[model samples]
Target chain A: MFGPFRLTNPLSGGLLWKIPWRLSRHQKYRQRERLRKVDSIVATLDTALARQGESMRKLVRWKAEMPTEEEMLPKDKYTVFDRKVKRYRKAIHKLPKWTRVSQRLNPPGF
Target chain B: MPYFRITLMRSGIGLPEKTQGVLKALGLRKRMTTVYHPVTSSVAGQIMRIKELVDVKEVGTALNKKQMREARRPAPGYYVERRGTAELEPPQ
Candidate 1:
């Protein structure tokens, strides 16, 4: 039943209101790029400190904890290992500040 | 002493108050604002807390506010070949 008083296209309905469970290909690509950028920044800091014959323990731990971009599998890159989710995993983009924060590592054997 | 050159790259909007407080403690009030502190365990811990939002580098020396500002300032496009009119030779 088309309402005579309404002036709207049905196609416009639900066009942009959905939050997809999974990320788009473009989002995945960008996420990977962001991870690499963070990595390089850390490496730069490390090398700079190395030149000064000093280092931070936290940086050393971070390097050991997180996997590099090349080290990550596509599955792990697009999704993070989570224990609470039904299948023990969730899309990385589901996390808050996903683009701005680093969440590359998961608990052991998750 | 070596220093940590920390530059805030992301806004702390929607984050926890404690996190925002850390940003303030580091003197990072706005995005792209940089502050330098001597490289120490305490400063490193502060950095670890907000690593996701900053770009850090270690330098041999720390830069004060004025030095950092001067470093960012661009070279003057025009120089005085002869001093300005007020200081120029009088009526000659």
Candidate 2:
């Protein structure tokens, strides 16, 4: 006979998120779509400002500096540099609300 | 005078209250709902707070609720040009 389930998280004793170590193909596809959508939004905003002969400081900065989705490397796309994680790299999905937050930029010299 | 046309692309069902408050402040209550605001740093900052959940575009003018709905409506594929004459039409 089996005992208890013995599948409890020591810290919370609640539902624990079993985050995977690597990104799945579907997840990678979705992440790509999200990044591209943000890029297009920025592009649309920039064009709209040009039409009106006006510009927002942040928009200008974004257009000037932010890398497009196509420009990012595969490693950066799937994992982010984290000082706490082993080897200073962690899967992007491990972050809380990862889908609802943009983790595009990594710390320089990381 | 350009305005930011922001549309909520994702739900805030399980997100933090602060994030939900930001979306509420932007007048986005549900997914695919759009709101427009003049391009200001304060408004931009709010958008930044929930950027991953929205799709933003810059437009010269904002459309009203009716216009937004109309824009989303699909065109009819076929039109009835002739009036029906026979009560019992043969089935093809």
Name every residue pair that clashes in candidate 1: none
lDDT of 1 by residue, A26-74 (tens): 9988888888877877786667666756688888998887789889878
Global CA lDDT of candidate 1, please? 0.81
Model 1's CAPRI class is acceptable
Task: Report per-candidate TM-score of chain A alone.
Answer: 0.78, 0.82
lDDT by residue (tens digit), candidate 2, A1-110:
23466545643477576767889999999999998887776676566656656667887777677788999888788899989987899989888888877777888877
Interface RMSD for each predicted structure: 2.5, 2.6
Candidate 1 runs further than 4 Å off: A1-17, A83-86, B74-76, B84-92
Poorest stretch of ten by lDDT in candidate 1 chain B: B83-92
Compare the candidates by TM-score and give the number of the best one.
Answer: 1
Query: What is the overall TM-score of model 2 with all chains considered together?
Result: 0.71
Local lDDT at B78 for model 2: 85
Clashing pairs in 2: none
